[model samples]
Target: MTIQFYLNGELRREDAVSPTTTVLDYLRVSAGKTGTKEGCAEGDCGACTIVVVRKNGDDEPLYEAVNSCLLILPQLDGANVVTVEGLARDGHFDPVQTAMVESDGTQCGFCTPGFIMALFALRQGNEKITDGTIHDALAGNLCRCTGYRPIVQAAHQACQDATKDLYGELSPLIPGEGYEHNHQKFFAPQNLSQLAEMRTDYPKAMILAGGTDLGLLFSKDRDPLEAIIYTSSVAELGEIEETKDYLEIGAAVTYTRILPYFERLYPSFATLITRIGSRQIRNVGTIGGNIGTASPIGDTLPCLIALDAMLTLYSKTGSRELPLEDFFIEYRKTDLKPGEFIKSIRIPKLKNKQKFRAYKISKRYDQDISSVIGAYRIEIDGLRVKDIRIAFGGMAEIPKRAVACEGAILDKEWVEDTALKAGLAVTTDFKPLSDHRASKDYRLCVAANLFIRLYRDLTDAEDLMEVVAA
Candidate 1:
């Protein structure tokens, strides 16, 4: 089979006999574009970061930063890609490269290319970049040399040059017919029906999306996955729509696109999303992917359960929607059947009278798994709780709803004594196991304390004097 795509502003094609070949291997060995380094084969490190620019229309292009290590070569069949080596124009360094040189950003240079590519996508058309923006833009790239100050300074400087074109106008790098291989085949289906049919035909095929999680199998586990099926090319899986009652997010939608909607509807959830991964990870990872993985410590699960989100699953048989809470059976297991995939997620819009909050406890503030996560949604009728939903993660074999605690809180008066009592009842709901990140006792304590915090914030006490006096 012949796999072709644009590489470094050139049309490149390769012949591979096996579908197991990864884009990282193809680029370094077959295509000889060594600038895209492979630091941690998993998507954790941004050493393999590259920009995948696809045509939305003739006027505007959609650019996203993705980990090259996890991508199968066939996924790039018709898309245009920009690598670190392609950033320059006419033998001149791009503005980002020039700024990095001026700011003394490159020390060891192993991570330089990845950082440059991240900044290149981040600074594409922006006129000014602030410290916070630079920090967020380069969050995925890790510098072991600890030379972050200069690199951040360089990004800021690159943004100041408004007249300079950091990314020049270039044609899409589409592969040609000259390349041929017999053993491997790549399929990119444009619609959901086509994708479903292909999936039904090949149930054992490896499905590739953002590769944030799937990429780890190759890099860390060193497992070879052949018979690859690429999902990014499917248009139906990436749509986002807002209706009168709910927000619908397609499975292929990236975290960057959906974060703003989640922020507007659920502010507390936005904070949790930021901690799920770095900016680059967010750019490539999808909400559906997070739900599909069904990890015990998945940060989004608790919030999704609290929001009463619905998961829509599609297969060759047909389409069905189920509450997200019911989709998980245990750690790393979901209710999805063979040849079936998640289509989209629907979340209800909260009303003004409703109170909602989410909390994540982790050893580090960002780029770490949750030690314990709690999400609460409550409806208050005057001074009493009309209804309540409480969800928790990292407290059991699966992320679960604390129905016992919810039962205790619903219809109860909004008071400190009641909240404290309800918090204790939550401990009886689940027995968390000890892990390296936290202990069973700590998880229970934090879970209860989070509920108390939420109650206090909602009640709005007149003063701290009452607590002090008591």
Candidate 2:
């Protein structure tokens, strides 16, 4: 079986390549498109950035910049991929490339291709161009020799207008169901029934959503995946069902697809999502994958727990709903049974006088794991704490709620002193470990200080978020 995709506007089919082969290796080794460099095999560096154009449910073209290093060959089975080499058309450079040349955005040119591709996707977006958007778009791509001044200038000059000419005429494809090469099976089911059947048959298959996490095994570790069940192609798993009480997000929904809802419902959580990784990571990363990973420092876990999210786990037998907080059993362990997979996450909407705030404490603003993440959902009645839920990450073996902290502030006056008392109660709730990212004491201190920050934030302080010098 062959995996089919449009590479640089040319149809390409591969049957000999391993399904686990990363797009980076496939492009450089097989396709001989070396313009996309491999500075870091991991997704941290933007050197392997590439533009993937796919259609959404509405049949609208979605131009996304993703890390080629972290994407497998089957993941691009029905999409149009644009590399840096594809930017020039008819002997003329794309506007972004011209802008980069005129603005002197390249130094050694190793990372230039990634930057151009990132900007190429940005230029295709309809979002209003601003300094913040420009920085967010370029955050995934890093350049050492050339400073960001020219890069910023180039973004300002080029991305001010959205372009639809490139790949606009390309039609969407009916997603391929599955592929196999050399006994390695890759299943891409289009519906829930098919997924359930496949899950029951191949219970040990690596379930891939965005593949940002499991792709590491294929890219850096060179692990051989005997079987993979790709979930993104499943229509039901990609739906976003909204009700008056809650928003039900399919487990396969990408972070980029769900950011708009978060921006409207939970702005602070949206801000935190932007920092989960760079735009490249978010373009393909899913919150369900975040919860499944069950990392102590998973940025979305604490926020989802504080918001009281619920999960819909599906299996051949049936589906069961579980609280998001209770799903994590221990460090890097979850309550998922064999043949069971996450179907959707349902997050309840905020009620009257309710406010939510989440803060991610990391060394860098973007593309860094959290040192400590604190999330709060508090309800107030005339300066009195009516109800509150607090959850923290990077503080223990699992993303846990601070019951002691909540008890400290519940039914008390929402004041500085009350916030401080809750902060002190953090000691009773968790005993964080000392790791390379931060010390135990430092984490405790920061976790405590986040309460003060949350207090100030809910009280309508001008400086809601801390400002750092760039």
Cα deviation of 379, candidate 2, in Å? 0.3
Model 1 per-residue lDDT tens digits across residues 61-106: 6566777887766666756788888888788888889998999987
* TM-score to native of every candidate shown: 0.91, 0.97
Best by lDDT: 2
Candidate 2 CA-lDDT value: 0.90
C-alpha RMSD values across all candidates: 2.9, 3.2
TM-score of 1: 0.91
The alpha-carbon root-mean-square deviation between model 2 and the true structure, to one decimal in Å, is: 3.2
RMSD of 1: 2.9
Clashing pairs in 1: 1-181, 1-182, 6-173
Off by over 4 Å in 2: 161-163, 460-470
Consecutive 10-residue window with the lowest summed lDDT within model 1: 176-185
